[model samples]
Target: MQSGLALLLIGIQLVYAGKHSLQYFYTATSGLPNFPQFVSVGLVDEQPFTYYDSNIRRETPRQDWMAKSEGEDYWEQQTQTLTGTEQSFKNNINVAKERFNQTGGVHINQVMYGCSWDEETGDVDGFDEHGYDGEDFFSLDLKNLRYISTVPEAHITLVKVNNNKALLEQKKQYRTQECIEWLKKYLQYGKSTLERKVSPEVSLLQKSPSSPVTCHATGFYPKEVTISWQKNKQDHDEDVDLGELVVNEDGTFQKTSTLSVKPDDWKMNVYECVVEHKSRTIRSILTEDKIKTNYAPVPIGIIVGVVAVVLLLVIIAVAGYKVYQKNKGFNPVNASDDGSNSSAHSDPKA
Candidate 1:
């Protein structure tokens, strides 16, 4: 429910007023403690654009940038739309801030947004997340940005789980009603945004000089891509680490898969990284250019050396204790010749 709603919301939200493809996005984040700031620079279809913030601020585009606009005068008119939204949601953030009375915490807030289309499905999808101090206050579905579920509220986590009086139902109805038309409009407008895209650029990254080789792919669109390592054209799933799709600074995505190559196996350069996606299928060979060879050897040598040293010391200490007992004319067990134990008071010289 959470993931689906998020996907639907953002896919529909940005395409409002018939905006097409997402060229890219610019984001502002807070780094300092207790900093109160969030903003986004959304470039849509290269014409109808969104330059807005949580403080109810937005920008009006000049007439020359039509590749970014959809209908007539959309950018100038977006100010009122965006400002109204900011005003509506700003109160919630303020309330959350006020309730966070503890001082030791950093008191941070962040807003993230994304617009992406699935290549094979030709379906537009989006995601938005707003949080305070790393805890999610709410998540917005791009297709229905206004349809925030009360589930993610930090102050009232139980409001969603313990919902008995159908309060959650009421909220869902309100959100759905408010954004249904917008979702429809977004789907209709964004269907044509980059039906297909270029194949991802691929490479391999090593976590440590001696660890596994990570197969990395970047600059691909529609989000779905698969990466596999092969030797002699056969799958190499042993000790492989697969990563999820990671969005880049650009609208494209990146992903990785790590293949553990021991020192004995690392000499073979025939290892290939194969990436499959709707746009295209490509393979990158693990050559000296693709992989770095700073791999550190396993510490087995050091461990064996330490163990050998410890055992040698233990043996020498035992031998010295026996020698000292013999020199002092004392039996280590302190027993008599007839197999009876001697008393503690027995003289060592005797």
Candidate 2:
């Protein structure tokens, strides 16, 4: 199963233009402390709309639009479906443990399935894959309607799924047809939020006079964006490092691109960072005065006060980090012999 960290990385990399997707990630874990045994998360356009976990034993809406648009009957049905899925994942974890000859220690089973649609080109693609302990186990090939095993240990699952022609047909139909229709409906319901575009707040930052200057953009909608550097009014790529696109707590996105240059070099050239998103283009010039930094000198008394504040904040941050470490990793659900029913389509409203 893909670890929680791997799943998060996948989410970060799914940015595309004029493309929308609906994905479901189900995880089951064993021998984890202070975490759910099973968990399921559903995302539309990379925004989480629904969440379910063994501790809750019920599915809940993670977004306002989801709660307002879906009725009680819808949530109830979803909860029941996930309840079954939770059990299925539990059994799956046990099956995996046996397959690996593991009687104890941490283990994870994960399944990620989704469909993407490109509005401009009307192209549709679907994927369904499983992982164990952060390694690929098996995946569905929608084109050929077959299960591809990634390892010899997964051959048993591949054969079992392939032999069930009816289940294979259901999987294909769900991924290609039903999944697309549901994605459309979700897009319509959450249009105001999902389709809205927000420009980024751009800034140039540096830690010190000798450090690289970073052009940072934050609080932007629709993760598709570009950040480029220019030197002397020309495109520049040398000594530039692009950071990963990350999701903000408010559902917006942030990214950074760093440019390394000698302080004297930057003083002699016209350097700028260009950010493009939707129909907007923003530029931040690399100037000493424009760069925000914490290296400036201050009065000794003020510095002492700042040090005290920093020490307090560091203490709190360390405590929070300890708690975070305890809860880190994939959340899980119970498993069953038949995993077909756990598909996102199990929600009747879909």
Candidate 3:
């Protein structure tokens, strides 16, 4: 569909803020309309950490220039910024009688780079990537750009040459500042629905709401949203149980916050679920009806679920009892055997 293609052209948008990470990918695949044509497709994050296209405000390839053109800047940036020794990879791919040398190419090459960090501490939380060999696994320090890639070639050329140090410094700059601007610009141009906040669908769930009320807020955007329980316009933290933010299928996020209320508070329905988001601040009452939001009867559902579990356990117990009964008789000591032996000895005299 034209609409889907339009979305694809804008590149993939993912919530890097969820885990506070930025991943880079370097790839080459033959078999295109123009075999060696270069294209950028963003996935696993909001936008590519850096931009190199005709429309964006950056050093794009010149109108008459190509990716492999002599004295170019794109692939060199790819090699230096992320992959220090990519030239060797190109040489191997384009070796004699390969796709680069043939009319129809049949080779695919790719490298993935990823790291996680805490925004507040600015310390290295985690880092890893796929190297270019059989033993091509790497763990890295995002803060200082210290890395230990398993590939022997990568160790010799990249880590020894201090390539990751430069790459990390630049990556932080682009990810925090440039990446944000690019996402806004692209989303605005594409008329992306991401701009609209599909207000959080607050549902009161769990077996008990008054005793331990659960307010699940789903289908919210920007991931900067907040959920809490309040009573009489005051922040309520009584027996509160907070949950982590989780991603949803449709690119939005969901989270739950549970609050345990006193018996009287439950009867009076003096509680509300408050959702604070970039778009709006809204609240849903934790009334009796909302408490029944789980739809199925709480007592019935719990009773049925528990019965099923108990029934399963009983079946297992009965099965074990039958097996014990069957095996208990396997080595029986017969009472008649001793008496029969005595009788045979007594008859020997006759």
Candidate 4:
């Protein structure tokens, strides 16, 4: 009996494991000069693979595998679908402006929707939500088959969205069924690129002798990694700051963990930074020889000039949307016809 129970529990655990996801983000902006009026991005496993904007007026693949796998017909269809969505979102921004009683000065409307599939158990789930001006607008409650309004202004939208029973059913079916199918197809096409593993390059950095020692890892694929510190062969967590994972332009990820210790204490005790990713483990000893510092005998003028250039580039990147924010929302807009027109789908071929 115990064996049977253990088997059942293992099966249950397997049902929720090995999950993969596909997500889409749509954004529309008004009063933002010299920027695309509409933008849409598609991601698999949190890595963006496809992008479209009003300025480009075409669907382009961000990953080389995607471009190689999909043909011109697929790109053309995707472009057409997103172009229609772009116009719908533009109109939505206008309607949202009316609701907010604003003539307008830089407003945004954003929508995020996606589905997740458990490969081990064939279980699937999905979500759809919208935001306006960096705040939640409304979302679909798939379990209850209802619309949830996050703010008072979204109540009307919620009612209008929920009133269409047929559309609601269609949306649910698409998310739970069609979406998962497309995700699987994409996984197959990009398996080589998506499933490949690349180990990280580890380094220790310090700004000055008095500063905390930082263990940095970069160029790692799959994004699942852990960085920890050990003191004298024992786990050390106190006074340690873990940085958020950042994706490099090349699609690999980077992370950092900083450990604070007095000079005398670290010199006396053996300290190490351990990083674990996939089936590999890396250990870096914290020593004066391993620490790279910016306080070297560099000219102050050169340092100041480099810092200024970096700051200017950062500002321009932020203004130009070179780095997309997942939670960003623009001004609210009332969607038409259950907002179905705003949704984009994968090519029906194959």
lDDT top scorer: 2
- 1-350: candidate 4 lDDT, tens digit per residue: 11111121111111122788887766677888987887777778766688888888888998888888888877876776676667656766777787788895987766666688988888888776666665566666889877676477776666655776765776678789878888888888888988888999888887789888889887888788999999999999998999866556566777789898887889899999999998489999999998888634442233355435322211110001111122222222222222232234421000
Q: After superposition, how far is residue 40 of candidate 1 from its true place, in Å?
A: 5.1
Error in Å for residue 170 of model 3: 9.5
TM-score-wise, the better of 2 and 3 is 2
Model 3 earns a TM-score of 0.42
lDDT of candidate 2 at residue 33, scale 0 to 100: 89
- In model 3, the runs with Cα more than 4 Å from the true position are 1-139, 148-191, 208-211, 262-265, 293-350
Summarize candidate 3's per-residue lDDT along 1-350 as a digit string, tens digits. 01111221112122444334444333333343433222222222322223221122132322121222324444353323222122223333233123124645444333333334444565433222332211233333445555544444344334332443444444344344444443334334333343445677777775644356678777777666788887877888777888755545344666778777665765675688888887688798867765654535763354355445322211110000011121211111121211211100000000
TM-score on alpha carbons, each prediction = 0.54, 0.81, 0.42, 0.78
Clash totals in order = 24, 19, 1, 5
Would you list the C-alpha lDDT of every candidate in the order shown? 0.42, 0.67, 0.40, 0.66
Q: Any runs in candidate 2 off by more than 4 Å, and if so which? A: 1-15, 295-343, 346-350
- Candidate 4, residue 101: how far the Cα is off, in Å: 3.8
List the candidates ranked by lDDT, beginning with the highest: 2, 4, 1, 3
Q: Considering TM-score, which of the candidate structures 2 and 4 is the better prediction for this target?
A: 2
Q: Which residue window of length 10 is worst by lDDT in model 4?
A: 315-324
Distance from true location, Cα of 123 in model 1, Å: 12
Off by over 4 Å in 1: 1-36, 40-49, 54-56, 59-68, 71-73, 84-91, 109-130, 137-192, 207-211, 268-270, 289-350
When summed lDDT is taken over every stretch of 10 residues in candidate 2, the lowest stretch is: 315-324
Flag the better candidate by lDDT, 1 or 2. 2
